[model samples]
Target: MTAATPPARVGPGRATWVWRRWGVALRFERRSVLVCGTLAAVVALLGVLALGTGSLRLSPAEVLSALFDPDADPRARLVVVTWRLPRLLFAVVCGAALAVSGAIFQSLTKNPLGSPDVIGFASGSYAGASVVMLLLGSADYLAVASGSLTGGTVTALLVYALAHRHGVRPFRLIIVGIAVGAFLSSLTSMLLLSVSPQQAMLVATWGAGSLNGLGFEQLRVAAVVLVVLLICAATVVRPLVQLEMGDDTAVALGVNARRARFAGTLVGVALTALVTAAVGPIAFVALAAPQIARRLTRGATTLRIAPAALTGAAVLVTADFIAQRVDLPVGVVTVCVGGVYLAWLLVRQYRGGRR
Candidate 1:
């Protein structure tokens, strides 16, 4: 009789608790949306500034007008539509692609340092481009892109194969990648040395990864490749999340781990190749973007791919802006900034371990 009386309906308090939990979730979602919105706005503003403040210096209104009405003043139209817009688009697309690729690699390897650029894909592409430029004497964009894709894919396969004892271990993959990267880099240096002075100079500037010469054609190619790869990435996102669990759990959950890994590696390699072709070996977008996104999201499984892509786009566009204004190489700016950030990340990891 006492037990029956004690079963006072869990009515108002339970409802209140449910409501509070929902409210907390809504609040968290709102905060994430706000942060992402702010980031998008900032990136848009920076893009506008970058377009406006170059040697031509078009105002925001003029830039907008020129972008919309291509038949406007030919010079202004050309500067905005033909020249600056393509570069801006290239920076954004390349950045997003690289960032997404990095996030995929990091997740697959379960290593913070895992990225296409860090693991020698970019360097391998560079070597491929160098060979095409020097030996074949071809500056054709398609040829360069093809060469980059081949080089990066081959390097990825080699790394994977070398690292496969039973399965791909993170440390072994990294070590193999570094060793291969060094060998490819030395080969590139030798090729550069063998070429004529003019070719060498051209290669040197390209190697520094400036967004100076990219036109609409290059932008179009990069966009197509990026879109396709991104679509594939989206399709695989759920499986990839499952794959992040142990292999046995993933298998139990109906994930084909080996196939998923292969698909992810291909996508990652393709992205790196596209970026390397568009802008020669711009480092750190892939490395930094995912890390930044994870920090911003702060989820237990915080590989925010879309956010990472956006961050990468913002970083590259901003970096390109600085590079153009300061007359420095985009690669140089990225490496310097990325190096500092990487050091800070290492320190943070160390401190976290102590705690």
Candidate 2:
């Protein structure tokens, strides 16, 4: 009797790599591996450039030496390791988190526009952080992080409850998220109005989402938290992907659609909130990264988590690099670029619908 092949196989024609160990198996698409690797390399190269380019301008060699060689110049080490490394790490880590959040939401909603920024979660987090900043007058990391997380969690629950009717609908979720986000934004603005100019300015600059002045302390905590959240994300990702094949199909395949969606939503919210807490709300990485990955890979895979994340890291690092040259906040550059990308997406969808 012949043994049946595992379900993970994508059939005979596609290029796939499979690994088996301890009676377990893992399957990966070759193209995805290549693309993700290339994107990772791009991110690393960008990081090196970002670390190297500054007022003191070190070469790539100097950046590497300062990073690795203990005997390297103290000034070079201070500039690369002390001053620039944290910011670059923040960009990469936060960008990946946002992109993963975006991928999760977009998959759940089956809509390109289903991002945290579009669906009210980012606004909720910002509002939460703003509350801490203005009302509590606490600029402390832990306080702001707590407030942001609470706000985002509340917002997610609110959106989920509002969108639920028989079951949660993607279209309804998007509409409700937008409405809630707008309301929360208005409330945030009111809070800003109530604050003193100095306080308001602090909140405003934070809201603009700059990675300036962040250091090892913030990065260490944020990185550890993000890693934990990402591990949670990975656990839910397979079931989440199954759920994408429609709830009925997913259920038949032994997946609980509602449970998967719920868990995925929580992970996505946490990811966004963590970044918002650390660096404020960064726009468009979540929205654009997955779509960009899809196009770049020519829609070769339904699972987009890895590629989207890598693309996000590269995109944010590149944007931050540009931001440094222009002496602007990273958020401002993403807004300008992502605004254009969003407009283009809208027009494309409109044209497709008309046809």
Best by lDDT: 2
Q: What's each prediction's TM-score?
A: 0.87, 0.94
**C-alpha lDDT score of every prediction, in listed order:** 0.82, 0.90
Rate residue 109 of model 2 by lDDT.
88
Per-residue alpha-carbon lDDT of candidate 1 for residues 90-197, written as tens digits (9 for 90 to 100): 889988988998988888877777888778877888988888888998988899988998999888988898889988888788778888888899989988888789
Estimate the TM-score for candidate 2: 0.94
- Quote model 1's TM-score: 0.87
Report how far off residue 345 is in candidate 1 (Å).
2.2
Q: Worst ten-residue run, lDDT, model 2?
A: 1-10
Clashes by residue pair, model 2: none
